[model samples]
Target: MTPLPTTERRPLSDRTFGFLLTLPALVLFGAIVFYPLVGSLTTSLFEQSLVQPGREFVGLDNFRAVLDDQFWPVLWNTLVFTGLGTIAPFLIGFALALALNTRLPGRALLRGAFLFPWVIPGVVVSFAWLWIFNANYGLLNGILFRLGLIAEPVSWLGDPDTAMYAVIVAKTWASFPWIMVMLLAGLQTVPGVLHEAAGMDGAGVLRRFWHVTLPHLRGIIGIVILLEIIWNFQHFDTIYVLTGGGPAGATTTFAVAVYDTAFKGFDLGRAGALGALWLVLLLVLVVVYVRFAEREEQS
Candidate 1:
């Protein structure tokens, strides 16, 4: 046999070339993500006024002020919104996903239709629900009136009591499909034999799901729920467009609060502080997820 041809490796300079290749992306990341983060953090430490003569360094006074004033309520609102917005969808979407996973008629059509709400533009969903929840000439009110459910139209989006829920309902409608799709994908990964085994043990439908299905889905569910929390925590347009944090600011989420504090209140420092706090919360969750994923992979 002929001697094997000698192989020549690429030059060590390729490492530097690879670094240069990734430099653009690093620059872009700094420009968009990291730079703004640093800017926000720096701005939060100063007393920044939108219309005053100059900025002053006030340390954490802006944060103190924010906390002293409306921060508690706003934080509560944000938490509630995040919690309900995440939970309702996770549950309903899981159910819907489970149903869709079965051998049922119109399975393909149902799956496609579930995706419809998620695919629709947020603005369109907001406006559509705005009309549906409208006090006058809205479908929900019209149907309720016809059914004799109420003597007069209810201001679903106007009332402080109902505004958040109304927005939440729209949010749920838009978001559940996302969870459904994710859970459906997670469902696919679960071995069919597990279900068959459970069935052989005479496990009922709910029992099988609770025991076999949920165990496999727990990790995915947790991740999706956390993601939903993050999304809703930063959610802006829907609540803003529909309610504008109206009726005594019942629907004011963290994102809306940040906007109001910065633009409407003209208190950039406080807004920055609030934004920084929000960022820290999100970062913690991200770190947790990354570590968990790494550990899972290692295992």
Candidate 2:
């Protein structure tokens, strides 16, 4: 009998083959992310003027200057906006998710309607809210005036005390729908049998939610909250359009500060420094997210 011919195989090892498969993505990441990151870090070490020809080596002076002058107030604004933006939307989304998770009339339509804010462009959302919060002819003041809630038009975006809150409200409106969608997906994964068992044991609605619902949703909750915080920390468009970082910089988060420093202030070095610090904070959150995701996958 003739021996069967053996098929020849390529010389590449499995690991090598896998690396080759990922090479394109790695190259893309290098170009789009790593290169710019390195550029920003390098620029942070120098003083460069947009109008001038040369960059001066300043070491960490750029960082020192930012830290000593504008950093604290800006950081405070960022924290307030990010914190309120994240928490308010999260609560509203969670509530909506719970309400819609039940059997209800027009559930699908309601869900679609709730997603309007999330699907709209940030600029458009900013402008819509801009009109809503307008000092003169805004919907908010109009309603308030008719109801006798205010003696006069209130400038929601013009007052430092209220600008951040108004921005947060807009951010919340745009953000909650996404959170609702995520948590709603998580809610679907929950075992209905557990809920029934809890109900059979005479657990109240709030009790079952506190015990069964929350425990089941803990993983998704952490992920959504972290992701929202990261996104909010870098949020700029809403604040920019609605308040332009303020009547007095009340809404200037890190993203806005970086833009204003680079283009408006014409200080590339300081902008780079601010960006580097922003990158660090985001990196820390990313690391935590990666670890949490890994843990979730393992469990």
Candidate 3:
């Protein structure tokens, strides 16, 4: 057989060197990522206690306990919180992105200000909301009292009816900025000529947006929804700091429940089970996103 050409030899040599260059990073990622993942899975199969020296293998008993107890309610609450939180932020953020994408004055300043909520840490936002929900001297109640909206200050975080809503509002404030930035980036990719062409065809503003802008934004919206779902499902800090899953366990989301079980209740076994359950849910979401992304790629 004829020997390979010099060009082919050089390309193969370069590819080998590139792989060698990336080997360290690949090894580090596996150690940092897969190692913990496998460790967690192994831990989930056993009855472990943070206070104990050894873990007992319990197979599926821990999982069974999780399913039979208040886990169902916590799961339902998590779904509700994630769903509503994701939807509200997407709508509000998309609206804000649309508004800011216009040729309005001081648009840059407004866009920068829009990022303030996202720039603030989740803990800080939670504390701010906690103060706002304070019954006596909170900014919200003070304003309402001054406006004669109520004869007395309302217990925003003290009542089961309003506790979840208060947390949701605070979460929305912190999360909408991410969706706004993503949607704004997507909006910039849309050709202005499409809008001009639609206008020339006598399409109204609403019609143009619906027919032209939305199609271009579909992929970004899908990504935003998926990311929001994942983030909202695992959200703990805001809810923990704001309500501590209080007012009759109204806001006991899965993450909060996991923390309460492991730390407060001292049931590491149950906590591991809860973590495994969330891992399954997150895996399902990942599969869904992968399928959608594959479809988009094919289209």
Per-residue C-alpha lDDT of model 3 across residues 1-299, encoded as one tens digit per residue? 34355585476665576679999998998999888777766776888887878888999998899999868989888998899899998899999999999999999999999999999988999988889889988999999888999898899999998888899999999999989999999999999999999999999999998999999999989988997898899999999999899888999998999889889987888888888898899899988888888887788
Where does candidate 1 have its weakest 10-residue lDDT segment? 1-10
Clashes of each: 0, 0, 0
Q: For candidate 1, lDDT tens digit of each residue in 1-299? A: 34344446644365566688999999999999999889878888898877786788998997888789878898899989999998898889988998889899999888998799899899999999999999999999999999999999999998999999999999999999999999999998999999999999999989998999999987888778877877888999889998988779999988998899889989889999988888888788778777766765675
Best by lDDT: 2
- The segments of candidate 1 whose C-alpha lies over 4 angstroms from its true place after superposition are 1-12, 51-53
lDDT of each: 0.88, 0.91, 0.89
Tens digits of per-residue lDDT for model 2, 169-283: 9999999999999999999999999999999999999999999999999999999999998888888889888888878788888899999998888888999998888889889
Candidate with maximal TM-score = 2
Cα error, candidate 3, residue 142 (Å): 1.4
lDDT value, candidate 3, whole model: 0.89
For every model shown, what is its TM-score relative to the native structure? 0.91, 0.93, 0.90
For model 3, the superposed segments whose C-alpha errors exceed 4 Å read 1-17, 20-28
Any residue pairs clashing in model 3, and if so which? none
- Which residue pairs does candidate 2 place in steric collision? none
Which residue window of length 10 is worst by lDDT in model 2?
1-10
